[model samples]
Target: MGAMASRGFDHIDTWVFDLDNTLYPAHHDLWQQIDMRMKGYISALLGIAPEDAFVIQKDYYRRYGTSLRGLMIEHGIDADAFLDHVHDVDLSTLDQEPRLAQMIDALPGRKLVYTNGSERHARNVLARLGMEGQFDAVHDIVAGAFHPKPTAEAYQRFLASHEVNAGRAAMFEDLARNLEVPHELGMVTVLVTAPGEGEAVRESWELEGREARYVDHVTTDLTAFLEQLHLQR
Candidate 1:
């Protein structure tokens, strides 16, 4: 048992997974709660309607890697408060997926959760998925000093903190652009996303069309993907 072979993932010794949509399916609708909270926070901060705030929020997310970063830069808002408010969504929509847990357990190498969200949010999502303690670490936005994905510095800091060798690592994320830096850094990049999810929130920075050079693999079903690798291994 060595790996899927076709993907040439045999050399990957570090498996870094994104939380939220990557670890759990988009159908769970967990992101919707956070999305609502972000708009609410923005509306309150700017004294605008939720509808207007939503438009600005997404524009910020597109211009900046994260809406929080945009708020901090443009308005000098409190990052800690924004994080807490946006992540205060209910996790009732999420439930444990035993198959995913089993699949993650079978994978070889060190596993870690790398998210632009806060650790508290990651913990809630992981616990809801019954994946607590499975990952070696949860590197959140705070760990990256509030610099979110698609930002070179965040990736650099994460790799240094973990002492990770990018050449021997693989990153699984839902967004396409987030994988670009990883690919450039010599890490295999996998885009885990569905068409509906991609269309709903993916920004212009996300990979368009079929020429996904930065993405080494694409999978709609994370559990099945991992299972196939495990079987081949």
Candidate 2:
């Protein structure tokens, strides 16, 4: 680690992580399930073709930060039902990541999972990863009043609810766009990337501008990054 990365980690007392690809490797294709589900949900809700729904889904994601948020605003769809349907993904492929769990457990201070997903989904993912009880809390989309990450309001709500001081906090996320707000709030931001291009599951838009100034660090291997922090401490 460079001196800047080391210094950034030194002041962190609250570690916030994005649950999906950030916790588990993107190669697992878990988000692909959710992506398809979202398209299906939109198609059914809007009485549109799957192809058309795909366009609308990506549009809403870009405009509102989440497809759920877009549906709620544009069509007034039931957020709870939408979340349940989209997050009903099979986790059989996600094996227990004991090494990753141990690294997370060794991190100092309060740890949290802050996701655009539902709390139930976050918990389920954590359980599957063998990281149950490793976090202080799971702040989900509902907790932010349906506002998703990358939005200042959502992050503000998370900070207040968790009593976290942004100046002493660090956030880890796979989507670089989601880290902009946290970085602006004075938290150190880490972008978790896929191990290789062939393993990437995120959309191009999600990975755009990943090298932006808001990102303090970028690591393809989150376990190794956390282990490096442990060694530094």
Candidate 3:
């Protein structure tokens, strides 16, 4: 194994988890609502049909980190306003079916929430899912300078800000590319979401990652992943 790929699994003292689909299931159609809202925002801004706006919006999200980023750079829109619109999608759908509080309580060491969403959004989602008290730290997109996933620089920033020893840490993300730098940085990397879920959101299970590159392990469901965790040392 390469040097960066080895630090996470055995020697790490910390665990970093991605929020959004990694914590829940992407198949819940969470992105559908967000898509609708994004399309609405774009259509209102550019005077286009919602359908065409949606197509263009998807292109932006796929090309730039987020459609909001593209809008901010190209359309000169307010970042805060865009964030409010995109993240305001309905979250009432995230259920307690995964009941992860006990599993989190049973976790062995320091656990941190490293998400691309805003801190408030992360807090709300966690609260809605009954997992509000599980993590040691919460890092969000605003704090991270709007540079969310697949960016090695952001992960470096995350490590620097947290005073984390990357060599002694593990990171769990549903997005494959997000795990790349952590793996390269010697983190114990765990890919928490399954395949075929497209990468609509930052690291949503709906997206696909280049698993052959940096992924350490793969799990179809977070609940099942936690179940197997208890049996391990």
Candidate 4:
């Protein structure tokens, strides 16, 4: 939260967040479980080896924003089953981050989570983080009609449904590409960088913020970032 970063988010009235790596540190190792579950489900569904499934999963994620979306389009797979199986991985690794929760609570305006995952998954994560009731709403993939971030449709849907003034809002996400639409829509975009979680296209997908102009701010420490904003307030 340097002067520039603080000014970037100072006028935002709606705070949109991407869950997963954005809220919790990447070193927490929670996403590793989810990534494995996704690979397992893909392997079992397509009758392929884990290694092959891994390749397909990453490819689909890059091409369609989410593997489930790609599965639906290419294989006619049921979205619900995929979401359930992938997100059912253990959450025992996540610990309540009170300071992170405090940073969020202290922020002014409406808070919302717009994740590519399901409402159940979002709730579980929030509960684990001790911030379950903090959000004004949870806009999941279901709310996005199976479209994920980087999809203009999903962003439009979230804004319309929540009655958010995109120009007066800010979006914080772990993935750089996901911030593109938010930036185009006139929202301040913050990229939350985390450690390598070893996902399908993680390397290519993670660090694009450095070169992407859509990213207005970048921070590895989300709690500290938000805390600084709070202190400025």
Strongest candidate by lDDT: 2
Pairs in steric clash, model 4: none
* Global lDDT of each candidate: 0.86, 0.88, 0.74, 0.84
> Which of 2 and 3 is ahead in TM-score?
2
Error of 1 at 195 (Å): 5.4
Cα RMSDs of all predictions?
Answer: 2.6, 1.7, 3.9, 2.1
Error of 4 at 30 (Å): 2.2
Better of 2 and 4 by lDDT: 2
Candidate 4 lowest-lDDT run of ten: 1-10
Q: What is the lDDT of residue 128 in candidate 1?
A: 90
Give me candidate 3's TM-score against the actual structure: 0.85
- Rank list by TM-score: 2, 4, 1, 3
Query: Local error of candidate 1 at 15, Å?
Result: 0.4
lDDT of 3 by residue, 171-223 (tens): 87766767878889888777775456444444353255645667777777666
What order do candidates take by lDDT, descending?
Answer: 2, 1, 4, 3
Per residue, candidate 1 scores C-alpha lDDT tens digits across 1-233 of: 11243446878889999997899887776788888899999999999999999999998988898999999999999989999998988788888889999888777889999999999999989999999968999999999999899888999999999999999999998888889899999998888876555555655555462247787788888888888877666
Off by over 4 Å in 4: 1-7, 195-201
TM agreement with the true structure for every prediction: 0.93, 0.95, 0.85, 0.93
For candidate 2, write residues 120-161 as lDDT tens digits.
Answer: 999999999999979999999999999998889999999999
> Between 2 and 4, whose TM-score is larger?
2
Model 4 C-alpha lDDT per residue in residues 1-233, reported as the tens digit of each score: 32344337667889998898888877766677888898999999999999999899889988999888999999999888888888886788889989888888878899999899999999999999999877999999998889888989989999999999999998999888998988999999888876443445366555555557787887778888887777666
CA shift of 183, model 4, Å: 0.3
